[model samples]
Target chain A: MKEIATYVERTFESVPDSQRKSEIMQEIIERLEDSAGKLEQDGKAREDAINKAIVDFGNLDEILQELRGQETGKGKALSSLWFAVIGSLLVIALTVFINLYYSPGVVWFLYPTFAVIWWPLCIFFFGKWRKGR
Target chain B: MVSSDLLRGHLETILLRLIGETDRYGYELFSEIDGRAGGRLVVKEATLYAVLQRLERQGYITSYQGDVSGGSKRRYYHMTPLGKANLEQGIREWHEAQEIINIFLRGNIQ
Candidate 1:
């Protein structure tokens, strides 16, 4: 059990995201347990069967490579979106800070409102429009 | 014993043939391979997973979660129609290659 658990943990360490990593590790553990269980039923000792199962299951490096590919493929697109969002938000905050500091509030709310609100709505509708196309 | 290195080249064909019969969960998939090969071809889990990922990417297979009796959810993979077509093509090519190899092996060709 410890052997398989350690193996799973180590293999998944290269994989990103706790949720996906955990699910994969769990799937692997279930498979390992089942294989080892059948082996035990076939007359092998519990520990030996488990050890053999781990050996037979082989490594996760290739899986990790594929997972990393998936990570980057999606991450690249989302990361750019995040960069734009963060950059705009910082500029909006700076403008708001200047407005609050210099003029002591007249229409500073407009800066944050347009920055946070209308921008996302436009992106959403624009994305939907592109999809429709 | 057949080396896994030899088996690696045929993994896609092997999977297509197996999954063509029925949808298979990850565990049983490997077990069946081991069973069919008479324990001579023990596939590395990572290698099989990589193949599965590639098949899914190429639209050759699709996977879904299986709600088994136990709470554990298993990922079940089924071949796509495209996968069947691909397998058919692979089989044809293999047969042609096999014929040529057989001729060479039989000393009919240099």
Candidate 2:
């Protein structure tokens, strides 16, 4: 059992995302132990049960795929959020710079113009996000 | 008594159905499927969990940890309302597909 737990811990730590890796590893250890216990009661040798259970542990592609999907989704969301914030800040900053240095008269319209151009984009992205979810 | 593909379908159904019942830990869920399948289908530990995580992320299920004093704490999974509705829709679609397959195999394709 300790061997099995060690094996699982190593396998899980190999995965990124510490929280999920530990959670998954813990579950795997629990299940393997339960199966091993059953096999032992059925007269199988402890070593035999552990070896067979480990060998028959099945594929891990699905788990990898799930992790990949999550990573991509989070990366995309973060990038988009950063892009929007930077883009909005840039637009406001550029407008303020222009009003202060180039044309003092248009200062009153800077925020309103920024709103006119940025609000639609914000609304559109929000709508897309809501629809996607 | 089921082809591997058919067996896989049943596994999906069993997972959804079990979650529909109550939140169960992974090992406990495995036992339920094993018992219910009556030795016809045995779900691998890894495969079962991968599917559970997928279902949870898809909004079909949610999980929490429950303490068992003498034993290790277990992570429990429960079906969401969306899961129930999705299962119903899936069952209907599967039945329709199966009917079409049966009809074609029975020479009623014309």
Interface RMSD, all candidates in order, equals 1.6, 1.5
True lDDT of residue B25, candidate 1: 79
Model 1: how far is B91 from its true place, Å? 1.2
Instruction: Residues A36-117, candidate 2: write the lDDT tens digits.
Output: 8888889999999887777666766666667557666566765776777777767777777777788776656566566846
Name the regions of candidate 2 deviating beyond 4 angstroms: A73-133, B107-110
Best by lDDT: 1
Residue-level error in angstroms, candidate 1, position B18: 1.1
Single-chain TM-score of chain A, each candidate: 0.49, 0.49
- DockQ of candidate 2 compared with the true complex: 0.46
Worst 10 residues of 2 chain A by lDDT: A105-114
Tens-place lDDT digits, model 2, residues B1-110: 45556667656667898878877888778778778879677667678888888888888988888887458878888888999998898888888988998876876445
Question: Which segments of candidate 1 are over 4 A away from where they belong?
Answer: A18-20, A36-50, A72-133, B107-110
Q: Which pairs clash in model 1? A: none
